[model samples]
Target chain A: MIDQTALASAAALLGESWTPWLVVPPGLLLGLIFGAIPGLSVPIAMAVFLPVTVHLDFLSAVLFLTSIFTGGGFGAAIPAVLMNVPGSSSAVATTFDGHPMARQGRHSEALGLALAASCAGSALGYVILLLVVGWVADAVLLLGPLEMFAIAAWGLTLIAVLHEGSFIKALLAGLLGVMIGMIGMSARGDMRGTFDSLALVDGIPVVPALIGLFAASEMFRLMRRDYIVEDKELRRPAFSRILAGVGMALRHPLVVARGGLIGIGVGAIPGVGAAVANLLSYAETKRRAKDPSVFGKGEPRGVIASESANSSSEGGSIATLLALGIPGGSATAVMLGAFAMHNVTGGPRFISENLDLVYAIILGNFVQVVVLAVLGLGFLFFAASLVRVPLRYLIPGVLLLALLGCFSITGDMMGPITMVVFAGLGYWLREHGFPVAAVVIGLLLGPAAESELLRSMQVSGGDPAFLLQRPVATAVLLLLVASLFYPLLRRRRRA
Target chain B: MQGQRGSEVALLLLIAGFAIWLAQDAARRSFSFENLVLMVPVAGLILLLCGILAVAALRRAPQEAGGGLARVLGLLALLGGLVAGLETIGFDAAAFLFLLAATALLGERRPLVLLAYAGIMTFVIIMTLGFMLPYEMPTLLLDPPR
Candidate 1:
């Protein structure tokens, strides 16, 4: 795999890259814009731009799409930090500490940390890919339905139990979210809880629900404040502050490395990518932290853990896409379409024949990481100005953008309606001390857990002993049990 | 303590009721391995958990700080009306009106600033999203029906 011939071919490809350099800037910008926006995700941008890629050569097209992928990964975290609105679902965990850091007048540091970690993670992910793509994909395939259920269960439990509120209430909120996720028609085509609404047939759209729960609800809570940050002196966007943040992120090398490794492991598994990786990494980082209480209250490590994991997951997803010819999620699925457009297939055969192309793509991602850091810094200089906008303007403007974004998503009233409804519900839930993060995660992961459990039961003829078959599932189950009980035990010991 | 706890209990009861309703709906289907398979089991579990949580919540005092209840309610009402008015008044008109109402509701008292902000926001939205993006939102003023 590390042959001189392959290395020379990669170098040649890099040297002969005609307009690939030209496409990189626009590709990253397109990704950043789409990712920063509320509803327009990386997949949507890639899907829309995929057709244009047909006119370009294969290498340039893949390079352009992946640049968007890399840019969007970090771009999603901006709104998550500043507004508690995850521009994409992958950034949901980023909001846990990122928003608190913003509220504490540390928004620049948070954004900088996220950017630095993202660049580092992307570079590391591709390095791992350049070494052992085959091993990563094989490991990912071992994660069956049982293992998925355990992972989802672990995430929900951790999110609920780790909150500063009443544990039971958090659990209730999480359970309610899962129930809401099961609202549409089930896998068997039987309607579960549509309540006679035709829109319920297709299930509640996650993006609108997320915008409602996080952004609109936060906007409502923010109506009392004049500005997001109360101290007038700390509101301006400063390049020095961002550099300080970058320095702080560079100081914590271990956290970034751990997050990146977790991302690669979880992201390679199909149907579970950055969405789960960020949350899992954050939870794990907090669990191992010296002072876990600082996690949701502006801890820089939280942002580092989340951003690195989500960013690194891109490499793992691409590994699965190339080596196994399996797309890990929607973004990679769009890349698969790009593959089709170029009349190329990705599998073992492609790997055997075109080892140089694989190396070129990975090498391009490494360059993307460097380009993203420079470009992302410039973008943040402008984005940080958002904190300076008064609440009165910010509230309505963000809400309007969210409403229109939702409309763009559903192409009907359903999107806006779901958003407004969830906004009110989310506000009430937040007032009652329910962990909205738990609810959102539950909503996001519920469908996967449900389907996995159903599939497990189907495979085992509805026997509870079916869980005993998978060793990985058993180990995860044990870990889940420990996670649930360990916190209560510690509380009791403190008392 | 009692007042906050009462509200918490009520919320939990509502959730429990919803869970029960969901379970009942799931039960309406046959117990085939394929149809409504996980729905009944999951709904039942949710109902049980909601009941347990409701009992637990009833015994606790809420410690959350929520001072802006009225503001939250007001904004929600405004957004509700904005959604309802979108198709009739169109995206541009409805958005401009909603911004004006929202800014005022959120304590922006100056008329000129409000007008300027609303106009600029509406223009930017129409130009960027309405014209630039491929989204085909229903609009009366900007994108009239053929």
Candidate 2:
């Protein structure tokens, strides 16, 4: 599978140019800034910077863009650790343990673990892509609607795994999120709960709704506290502590490896990317642990699982974009635009013809990972200072930023309006001991689940027997069933 | 404890009620297979969960203390006001006023600190966001010279 000639050419091409290396730092910085903000995302940063790539060679352009992808993957975890605000949907699971750690005055360690896990995951993803880029298209082609629905069902099992207080309440919250996610128009041109509003036609915006549910609601809860870290002695950011955290992540090689594999697999699918990948990885990691109760309460392994999967998902997404000419998600979609700018099309033909370029792209990401580690340390050092700010000022300040960010998302009042409404719901849910994270997972997976199920139904003409024809889908569904009952079986055995 | 329990019950009912309303609306539209494939089953599950939760709430007494209701409500109102003010006064002025009010409500009594923090922070945020986003944000005081 390895192309020796192409590999040599790729090395020569990279070594020939000092220009591509220079763009890496600025691109990474741009992604970090965009990804660290609550409303903005990696795709947004790439979209904003796409025009600039026109001034450079194709190799330089892609390197710059991929560097942004690398940086943004880790950057999104920053706010999730410090403020219980996932900067993007992909970082939601990171907050499950990350924010709790922050509250416990271990914010620096959480940030460090996220950073190290992210770099390792990105490297692992690219290494896999480097080996399998030639065959990824054929593999991706086998996933039909039935299989996709099965995968989504597996993702939804996260709700059960994330249960904390009341299992009934968690189910209620998750189901409610599913209902909310289905509020817009159906696939068959039928409007369900639009309430005659034009904005509701597309559905509730996910980013703002999540920001409201997690960040704004958490801010309301933090009103009684003076600072994020209650202990004055633990509020300061220490470089040594961050290094310890990095060493800590390295100790758990199996968790990082499993998360990376899951990320790459899920991210390769179209319409599903890091958002589902992180949750599924976290669920699987928690499920397999000897004592699953340690999760979601400042567990470093939870942070590692979430961060690794989400970061590796970028490479998984890039695999689809490169091998099939299909944009895996919005970020890869923007990258397709960059490809067009340079008159380069992505597909089997592109891969076969420009194997050298493909190798160069994958190899460049490996280097980007190293640069990311160096830059991420500096970034974490500065971001870790957020715990020092008093909640009195930090609360309002972050809220204003979120409000403005939401406003920028929709260019109207709708974004902020949705955020405020969900903020109320989130606050009540949190106050009443419901798992807000379960609701978030439900919201993220609901539409995908519904649409995929509808597609499966249409394909099978409502016949349940069609499931037997697709062994993969049947196996996945069975796995989902097993996962659902495993916890109960484990508890029963322990008792 | 009673208040907490009451709030919990109300939330469950609210969710159950919303699910019913959505299902009814969908059925009213056409009850097509595509429209109800996911909704009907999900709505059924939500109602069942709501019943279970209401029972659970009644069985167990609330143990968590509640003292920050007023501050939380005040913050919520301030946020609501900021959203409302965004359209009337534009982002720049409205955001500035929100920071001022929010800090005051949160117990920042020093006038100079509040003014400086709100002014500088809002200006920096608005300016930074304005430069980064492509959309034309509505701003009263900070509108760029076009």
Candidate 3:
């Protein structure tokens, strides 16, 4: 079952001393710090380290990447539990429960619990990743262009519908992102909208666009603050605190399992990635909680569900990336390039031939859990202190990081240019209270929806009922329509 | 800002403008139309209507002036430092300088303290990212002696 060649290679590159014990905690801890920091996001951290992945063996490289991801996922809980700002999009769910707990001076408990659930979720994801790739992939292969389109449309509509404030505003932001997305060499024959800059030819790199929206805007907004990161309570978070965290997670296994399943399902979908997965998972936790009313002001259960599901989703997402040449998310897309650099071709046939390598990847993740558990504790302790860093000091530093992060993406000024422009746009929108998440979601779903529409056009020969003619596409479109419109309808009735 | 209630009222006009822009451009380039793009102005018009409705709601509420000129200018200068510093001095040189200088501008004043924090942080970042990870920074600028 194992590729002895890859297995021996993994053991060697992971280093004789770099057992799962050493590898897991630090990797988890590093990711948590990245996640806990207000503006330092998982994707930014991933891109910064992407070049390094090229230098390592395939499983070892993915192990490192996933380690950063795991750390970052739990890291968001720190800020949410402390400062009320979610470190990453996925952590938005964490804030529902984590923040209130912090307000109640249970920051330690909230952070610890989120960490435990996150690790549990990651462990479960590894199990699924190891077992499901060979058995269930054939079932999923039936997803056609129409199904993909419907799903993508459903995703876009869901994003637009679910955003805070005006539904119209959310859709507007999405429309703008789609316009920005259209700026590069689209699959269509027309040069589209690149206005002749060679930089625009390949389309905008998702990392830079994301950096501009999330990282740069965050930095700019924080630039004038004089944040004083308050130190942790001198009493070190006790082992008892961690034990309570474990109890809380297991007690609500239902919450943890549901979140993990969301992560896995979202991971399996093409185009939709962890960001969307975590968001939908959080929304579901909010929708179905025993105390749905307790959500949003800080609910520990909300944090646990979101944190666990988001981290768990990673293994499944990567499984899709490894087993199908198809990408499940942005991180996986980047990993694909990394895979090429390492001379590893990941696809169904590749996985079948290199099952050991696949197992090694899963095995490496299991090793990550110990690291994740230990570092999760470390990050939990530091989370409070990180929030105390004065916004003023943090903002300028982040802006600089954002710009630098952009340049590091491709080693060019264009990255910074994109960052500057998008950030300025962000500032303009921020003044109006527009949600940037809406824009990111729209941009992500745009090309897929557009391409699918193109397919429908070709198949229908321009029939007016083109989308409705196909059952799968119609079902998806209907789901999308319902997802987007339901909230508005509900709100209207409430008013 | 008039809450741009008129702007909201005129949202239909704005959508019409965008519709013309997209449709005319698509025609000029002979690109296939998605009709989904048509959703843009329609949505915009809806937003305009909503924006108009919100104007009354917003007026009753007060707005905070977010920041001042000094801060805005400072942010612009810091953004420039990102462009100029990395290219001029390199990642370590530029990063070290940018963090130090920008933090000072952002309000941190103690020289030795700022430099100490900046230097150690820069070194750690460079070693971790550049040496350990091999990320490509502006090496053309920083490849000089450490």
Binned by DockQ into CAPRI classes (incorrect, acceptable, medium, high), candidate 2 is high
**lDDT minimum window of 10 residues, candidate 1 chain A:** A156-165
Q: For residues A321-425, what per-residue lDDT tens digits would candidate 3 score against the true structure?
A: 777866676567777777877877778898778766677777777677767787566556555454456665566555655565566565677878777777766
List where candidate 2 sits over 4 angstroms from the true fold.
A487-495, B59-65
DockQ of every candidate structure: 0.59, 0.84, 0.32
The residue-by-residue lDDT of candidate 2 on B1-146, one tens digit each, is: 47788888889889999999999998898777778988999999999888887888888877554998888888899899999988788888889999999999999999999999999998999888787778777899896432
- Show where candidate 3 strays beyond 4 Å: A1-110, A219-225, A228-251, A289-295, A325-364, A460-495, B1-28, B35-73, B88-97, B126-129, B132-146
lDDT of 1 by residue, B12-102 (tens): 7777788777766756754566555555665676677667867677666665545776777888988998998888787888888999998
Name the top DockQ candidate.
Answer: 2
Report the C-alpha lDDT of model 1 over A227-320, residue by residue, as the tens digit. Answer: 9999988888999999888888889889999899989877888888998889988988887675788888899999999999999999999999
Q: Give lDDT: candidate 1, residue A29.
A: 91
Please say which candidate is ahead in TM-score: 1 or 2: 2
Better of 1 and 3 by DockQ: 1
lDDT of 3 by residue, B24-106 (tens): 45445653455334334434544564555455545554444455536655666667676776666677877787678777767
Candidate 2, residues A1-495: lDDT per residue as tens digits? 889999999999999968889999988888888889888778888987898999999989999998888889889999999999999889999999999999999999999999999999889998999999999998999899999989988998888888976677788888888999988888777888988778998889988999999989999988888999999999999999999899999999999999999999999999899999899989999998888999989999999999999999999989999999999988899999999999999999999999999999999998999999999999999999989989889999999988887887787889999899989999999998888888888888898888888888889998999999999899889989998888789888989
